[model samples]
Structure formats: C-alpha cells, structure tokens
Target: MAGPGGRMMMGQSGERSMDFKGSGRRLLRQLLPEKAALWVMVAAGVGSVALSVAGPWILGKATDLVFAGVVGREMPDGLSREEAVEGLRERGDGGLADMLSAVDFTPGRGIDFTTVGGVLLVALAVFAAAGLLMLVSTRASTRVINRTMYRMREEVQAKLARLPLSYFDQARRGEVLSRATNDIDNISQTMQQSMGQLINSLLTIVGVLAMMFWISPLLALVALVTVPLSVAVAARVGKLSQPQFVRQWQSTGRLNAHIEEMYSGHTLVKVFGRQGQAAQEFAEQNEALYEAGFRAQFGSGVMQPLMYFVSNLNYVLVAVVGGLRVASGTLTIGEVQAFIQYSRQFSMPLTQVASMANLVQSGVASAERIFDLLDAEEQAPDPVRGARPGQARGAVALERVSFRYDPLKPLIEDLSLAVEPGQKVAIVGPTGAGKTTLVNLLMRFYEVTGGRITLDGVDAAAMSRDDLRAGIGMVLQDTWLFGGTIAENIAYGASREVTREEIEAAARAAHADRFVRTLPDGYDTVVDDEGAAVSAGEKQLITIARAFLSDPAILVLDEATSSVDTRTEVLIQKAMARLAHGRTSFVIAHRLSTIRDADVILVMENGALVEQGTHEELLPAGGAYARLYAAQFAQAVAEVD
Candidate 1:
C-alpha cells in the first residue's frame, strides 16, 4: 500500500538533510557561464542605486531652499541672516534663533519660485536616470537567466541519456521525469523572480548606507544596530525551512510517481477491484505533500514579517536620533528629513533580501535534485574508435559471462552460448530463468561482470553500442508506440528513408495488414503512445512490423506472439519462418509448440543451460525439457475435456 511504501520512500529521502549552503553555492556556479551578462547587470544596478541614493539628498536641497525663502519672508527688511539670528537670541526666543542659525535665508524675501523650480528639475532628472539604468539592469538579468536555464536544460537532457539502465531500474520513472521537467522549470522561475531584484536590493543597501553615513554617522550607527538581529532572524528561519523545502520536492516526486503508476494501470486496477485502495494511496500521498508544503511555506513566511519588524525598529531609532540633532541645531530640517529617508532606504532592501529566503531555498532544493541527477554515475563510454567488422556475420558467442543485479545475489554465472550465422535458436525457460536477460547482454544494455561476449570474433564491448545494436532487431512482449501515424511508427525502425510500400510490406509480413486495412485511415491512422485506437494484438503487431521493417541480420523475439489470437499467432509464425530462414534468430517462447521446427532448442532453468537439442531430441530425453512439455500437454488436454 502507498501508506507504508510511501513512508519508506520519504524516510529514505529524509536521511540526507539538505545542504543549504552547498546547494546555493552550486546554483551560483551555474551562472558562471553567463558571467559577462551578470557583470553588466551588476554594473547597471550599481549605477542606478548610486543615482537613486543621490536623488533624496538632492531633493532635500529643494526642501531647504523653499524653507529658507519662507523664513526670510516677514523678517526685518534690512537685516542679514546672522543679524536676524542674533536679534532673535536677544528677544528670548533661542529655539527659533537656533533653528534660524542653521537655516539659509535672505531678509525681506519670500519663497523664490525660480530657485525652487530649478532644484525640482534636477531632482526629477536624477530619478529618471536612475529608472532608465534600472531598466537596463532588468534587461541584462533576463538575458542571463534565460541563457543559464537554456544550457541547464540541455545538460539535464544529455545527462539522462548517459545514465545507465540500472539507474532507472532503481529510480521511479515519474520521479525522474519530475526532476527533469518540474524541478528545472521551478529553478527557472526562481531565477526569473529573484535575480534582478536581489542585485538591485543589495546595491541599494550599499549605496544607501554610504549616503546615511555621510549625512550623520551617529544616526547611521543607530540605524545599523538592528541589522545583526535581522541577519540572525534570516539565518535561523532559512535553516529551519531549507529541510522542509527539500522534503516538499521529494514528496512531490513520490506523489507524481504514484499518479503515473496508477493512471498507467487504471484498467488493471478496475479489473482487480482496487479503486478504493488506489484512492486511499493517492489521498495519503497528497496529504504528505500538503503537510510538507505548508511547513516549508509557514517556516519561510515567518522571516518577512520579522524583517519588517526589524526595519520598523531601525526606522524609529533613526527618527528619534535625527529629531534630537535637528532640535539642537546641529542638522537642518531638510538634512534630518533626508537622513530619515536614507535610513528607510537602507532597511527596505534588507527586508526584501530577507523575504527572498523562501524562493532561494526552494530553488536551491530543486537545484540539488537536478545536480544529484547530473552527478549520478554514467554508463561506461564507448571506445573512441571502436572495432567494426566490415559486415556482421551474425555469429555471437558468450564466454564465461556472469551478472548480478545485487552484488550478493548472483542471477547468471559462467553462462556461455554460441550461435553460428543463419541459425535459429529458440530459448525456452521458466519465468525467472534469465531468458530475456541473455538478449539484454548481447545488446549491451548492461555490462557483464565476469566475462566477455564476441560478435564475429570481435569483443562486443569493444564495439560501439550504436553499431552493435544496428545489426540486431528486437520486439519485446511489452509494446510501445509513439504519437504519430501508424506508418511512421513502423518506419521508426528503418535507418534511412522508407517508402509507404515498405511499411505496408512489413505490416503484411507480420499479419497486421488485414486488421490495419479495416481502420478508417488504414496505414495513416493516428495513434498516441497508448495506441488506444487498436486492440492489444494490433499494437503488438505494429511493433513486430517495426522490427520486420528493420530487417536486421539478427532478431530477438521475446514472447513476441503472446498478445495475439492463436490464428494470428500461427500466421505470424509462418511469416517468421520465412523471414528467419537465413537470419540468426533468438526466440524466447513459453509455448513449446511454436519452436518445434527450430534448428536447435536451448532450455534454461535457474540461470543454467540444462538442455540443448532439437524439440524431438529433448522431448524424449526425459529431462527438464521433457517434464515442462508433459506439463503443458496435460494442461491442454484437461482444458479440452
């Protein structure tokens, strides 16, 4: 049930805690290839922040100019600013005199509209330049993010192609697919949302801090006292939420795997009356995902408000300090106003950076999953210049070969077989007898642990996998069809361009032409991966037709006729008899009657070659093959009765 198996998967996944710092660093390294673009973005950000920082200071001057003109009005007509301040001190209004001492005013003057307008124009220009630079920074960040994700996707795809088949055996298909699709997309979104803003925010903090210190060092220090507390909040919350993010993505993968498995086998579930069981499993996985997602979100969500609280505290501190300086006449009203703005500017970016913890952590979590895939051990590479026999003679011989999926439990050991050119070898065995595994070894889907296999006296391992597989054609019991026309599906097997006539010829040879002609579109009928337009037998026939179209020197048929009716099966057998006459064919079958005319029949039991001879020779020997034939014959007779 999903309740226990899913928990076990979560347990296995949770065993490795998230390396938050390591993953973040690796994500940054992903951008190294786009370093030039990042530098452009950073330079633009710095310039924008610099001008932005100066705007407040410049605007404060306009405030001073306006205030000075107002104060100058209604003053005595002939007194200088110093004379008026002295006059106010003598009149027992020392507070006004102190403020006047700091204010620049001309006696007998009202607000000067010309000077005020000029300062306002300068302020507008400064801010507009800052905005234009920000636009440039944003554009550059977009280029960097897009290019980086483009390359990352390409790398992930290529990595999947290089991974060994054994890796997929151990990994869940939907989980791997999610990592390649969903996780990569998540990473792309994270960069898109965070990269440019983070750059601007960080540069804003630096530029704002400089202006704050230049205005008043004491107030700047007062504003900075709460920064350590903000940092502590961010780090602690990030640590708590980082593992939750990792678990969330893992849960997503497990849930996806379950959905894919159930949906793919829904027909079987219905036949077995397991709908309740399936729904319960789905509910359990969905619940696990909800919990993980909630915790990760709530944990990271705590940081933004905390940072806001810290920013407010810093704001209050700067206002109090700046107000005191203004009252004492050490700083002007405009300077204190500008200093208050600078303090806010400094704290806002910190809050933004703190708030980004969620996106950053989630993105890094996905990056780690993708990086794990990229870091997995790849299958051994082919030789640069591999051995190539000019033409394959269809001679394959295994010498003392051995293999084990698990190191401790051997499946096949010291098994050897040789097939001469143009020989039809029928391999018959029980379910766990390694009959299909023999074909896999010959095709080099897996590497043997102990011995070597040779084709035409040249080592198979020395030959490129592409070259080796090109000479052999395989039709599995499990059929697959992509989304395309039926004719195109058959043509997939051909290495070069194939005509419509060739596709029809292959279909006829596989006995599929009659049924295919009944369809509305005949060879041109469109079918998806499920091949729902046709019966299971027709799907199998299409795959068999594909193999026929290839016309390789060697053929591997693994229960290839199992899905068809007996009449169709007999027709396929007759066709195979004609086509396999001069080809080296390895046929694995459960029905012994199908291989009665084989040149030789090899019987495997528990990974050992126990009997080998013609059907007539082995049936009378009274060994493993004789017992198997007797059991099947008895079953057939009893069914008839």
Candidate 2:
C-alpha cells in the first residue's frame, strides 16, 4: 500500500525494492521496547528445542538395553558357550567373541524391564515438557507482537497529523489509507506468525546439529555439507523471487488506489459514460497484480521442494555411512537409528526457513513503506514568539505580499489590499487570478513568500495558526459536512460550546431551520461523509449556519450561495447580510449581481487589483469589471431563454 511517499512503483526489473539490511535494523529498533519479553520467549523456545533433541538419544539407549538382554538369553539357551564362540570366530567376528567374555547380562532373568521403563518414562516427561515450553513461548511471542503492532499503529496516526498539508495535497487518499491500514496489517501478520516460527526454527536447527555431532562426528560432517548447499539454493531462489514479491505488493496498492478513485468518482463516470474505459483500466491493473502475485509465489514455491531434495540426499548419505559402521560393530543399530532421526530434524528447520522467506520479504517491503511515512518532512514549526490573537479587531491589511505554490510560476505578486472593519470587500477576477490565494494567505493556511499580512495590525505569521483561523469563519462553495447530525455540523466551527438553543437560532438565521425541521429527525438527522442524504442547497445552508454559529470577526464567503436555487439563494443572501452586519467580510463570487452591494468591489485581473470602487462607479468605467459584468448578465439571460 501507498504511504507518505505517495505511490510506490516497482524497482528496476529483477531488482529488489528495499534494502534488507537497513529495513531489518529499523524493524529491530521497532521491537527494542519489547526486547525483554522477546528474550523470555526465546529462552522458552530454546528449552523446548533442547529437551526435544535429547529424546532420540535416550530412546537409542533403551534399544541397546533390550538388545543386551536378548543376547544374554540367546547365549544360555543356545548350544554350549564354546559353540557360540567358535561360531563367531568362524564368521570373522573375533571382536564379538572377545566382548562376550566381558558381558555381565546375568543380573536379571529377563530383559531389564525396570531400567528400560525408567528411561522410557524420562523420555516421555522430557517430550511433554518440551511441548509445554513451546506453547508458552508461542503465547508470549503473540503477546509481545500485538503490543508492538499497537504502538506502531499509534505512531503512524501521530505521524500523519505532523505531516504538512502539502503532503496530503500531493498524495492519493486511497494510497494514504492503504499504508495506514493494509500495509500495517501486513507487518502485524508477519511479525505475529512468522517471527516466532523463525526464531524457533533457527534454535531447532542448532539443537539438531549438536545432537547430530554427538551421535557420530563422521556422519555429522556429512550432514553439515548439505547445510551450505541447501542455504545456497534457498538464497538463490529467494533473491530472484524477492523482487516479484515487492512488485506484487506495489501492484496490490496501485490496484486499491485505482479502485478507490473509480468508486469515489462513480457518479462522474456514469455521467460521462466512461464505464468501459474504467473497466479496461481496472483490468490492466488487475492483470499486473495477478502476474506479480503468480511470479512471487512460483519463486518462493521452488524453495521447499529443492530444500527437501537436498535433505533427502543428506539422509541417504548418513544412512549409508551409519550402516557401514554398524556392520563392523563400531556403532550399534540403535545409534544409527538415532542419527537418522537427528538428520531429519536438522533438515526440517531449513525447509521451514525457506518456507518463510516470502513472508519475510513481503513484510520488509511493508516496513519500508511505513518508515517512509514516519520520515516525511513535517509542517514547519510554529514560532516560539507567536501569541494567540484572542479577539481580532476585524481589520486586515496585506502589504506587497508575493506568494506562489511553485516558486517558478508566481501566482500572487506585489499584491496589496486593505479591508476596513465591518466592510464587505468583494474580490472578482478571471479564473487564474489569485482570489482564493488571498484567502489562504489571510488564514495562514499557506504562508506568503514575501511581505506580510497582518490581522488587527499583528503579523498573521506571528500569531498561532489556530488562533488566526479561529477569528475567521469561511463558507466555501464546496461545502464540507462531516459525518454527524445536522446540529453537530452546524456547530462545526463554533469556538465555544454551543447549546441547543444557540444552534437552533443560528440555523434559523441561516434560513436552514425550516428545511431541517422537515426531516423526520429534524436536527438529529445523520449525514454521511459526502452529505449524500441532503440536497446541495441544504448542505450549503448548513455550512452557512456553521459560519453564523462561529460569529467570527472576519467572514469569507466563497460563492457561498452558488449551489442554492434562486428562492433559497434569496434566503441565504438575507442570512449572509445579517451574518456580515458587523464583520470585515471578503466575498469571492462569479455572479456579479450577488456582490452588487459590496462596500468596495476590488476588480482583479491576473492577481492585480485593476479597479476599486462601488458597483455604480465601475459600471461606467468600461474596464475589465464592466466587461465581466456584461458577460455574466448575458450568460444568465441566455440560460433563462
């Protein structure tokens, strides 16, 4: 999934996307807080492996005890002792005859059942203890992993808040969400299920190697040769497949992003009849995802069979060498049996390690994405000397303020304006003129690159952003109503706690109270994120009510009534007139007639105020404002016809 880095495309073909060494170190650091608990779990796993390793050897000793008892019984029940010795010598088994004289198996009439039973009981206890330890370690690891993931999730959320608004503007919402949810989920799953198994597998391999060496150094050396060979095989395959897994994950993120975009714009797609085009795009992304997934699975899939083959080959070599030693009486049958079990145990963990390679790779890829977000450039820190503008006096002055979203292409340059307290200043210009840019600067959403804007004679930059924004209320054309009841949305920008009576009064002032009462639940109606349940005009009214409730000293209405019908527009204008009665207001409207009553209409062209006067003064100037006004009326007349 995408993160703060936005889109994550695949690396060069066949090249892995992440640096394993760097990501591994970072991942380790993330787990450092839980280190003590992890160590305890590891200790339990080690204990389990140690006990399991001893079981085979003890059973071999028990086998030897039974063999010895059988030999003792056979020697007495057969012909004479001399006959047994001659038979051994004749068979070229002189060593067996010499060992028989030293034998003292006559301590019991039958096999030493008590001794064998004791050894068997001890083995059973050890096995049971090992199982118990394994369970404990598994549970411990689970607990630690869950806690660590929770911390990581919290950090991600905190990091998102610290990020600059520019980051959100550039990053896709779906991609950002993908990182916060899907990518984090992937990391959690891998850490919980794979990490514990990985640790146990390594410990098991070590324990098995120790037992293999103790059984027979010669056979142990033979088994050791396959270790490097198996690892080499796994490494080679994993390297080729690692890129595929990276690509697979990236493609999945892209697919999710595409789906989210298309779904959100589903209405637009239908309006434009672009279903076929959207489906084609979806198919292409899906195919890419499928190919990446298949290749990754196929690459990691080869490791198990290859490791198993290597394991089986090592087992055959050990069996052959062990059989030779046993036949010559240098090693007993029971010892050979124990070595075979050890060899099998040793190879099994390597197979498991190979099996986990894909998960580890995929998890590391997810970690890299998450780390990128945590490492993004944050918003510039607020000045230490900044103070809160508790109550602005509604006076705003812009000096020769120059600003640009991109430095190379200046949008607002050498712009100067003065807004008197309680005056309605209407800003109008062509599409690319800096109408909204001025609002952004005034609110300090984006700081000016040169000069300064002051609110009540205090530099806006010198005031805390929250305080500056608190003094200004905005009703935008694109009304934003979060998921809440009508009353909650209306009280959105209010600085202080608003009672139900205050909310109702604000709604009534905005002319929204009548329509709100028509709903079954009145002010308690639930609105979705997009406010889909309400009409566009109703949403605008709610936003206007929000502005009225805020009752800021400075108000901004950016096409506030653009979405409402003619009848509703008249009501909203009346509400706005009352709301702006005692405030310094900026109205940015394309409908020239709506701003005809503005105290001073600032006719802007290309970010420069070309003319400044009341509506009557600019009507006869035959300037840009006159032309724009004429065109607007003509368009409206044509629409009516």
TM-scores, all candidates, are 0.96, 0.90
The superposed Cα distance between candidate 1 and the true structure at residue 539, in angstroms, equals: 1.1
Each prediction's whole-model lDDT (CA)? 0.87, 0.84
Encode model 2's per-residue lDDT on 1-641: one tens digit a residue.
23234543322123445677698689878888988888889999999999999999988888877876777676645455556666778889887865553333442344899999999999999999999999999988998889889999999999997776667766777777877898899999988869889999999889988888877888899988888899799889988988887787777777888899999899999999999999999999899989999998889988899999999999999999987777665677678888898899888988999988888888887888788778877766777878755467799999999988776787778878888899999999889788887887888767789999988888888887777888899988888989999999988868889999999999999899999999989999999989987998889889989998887999998876665688988887888788888899999978898888899898877777788899999999999899999999899899999
What pairs collide in candidate 2?
A: none
Tell me model 1's lDDT, rounded to 2 decimals.
0.87
Task: Compare the candidates by lDDT and give the number of the best one.
Answer: 1
Please give, for residues 454-494, the per-residue lDDT of candidate 1 as tens digits.
98888999999989999899877888999999999999999
Q: List candidate 1 stretches off by more than 4 Å.
A: 1-11
Q: What is the Cα-based lDDT of residue 628 in candidate 2?
A: 95
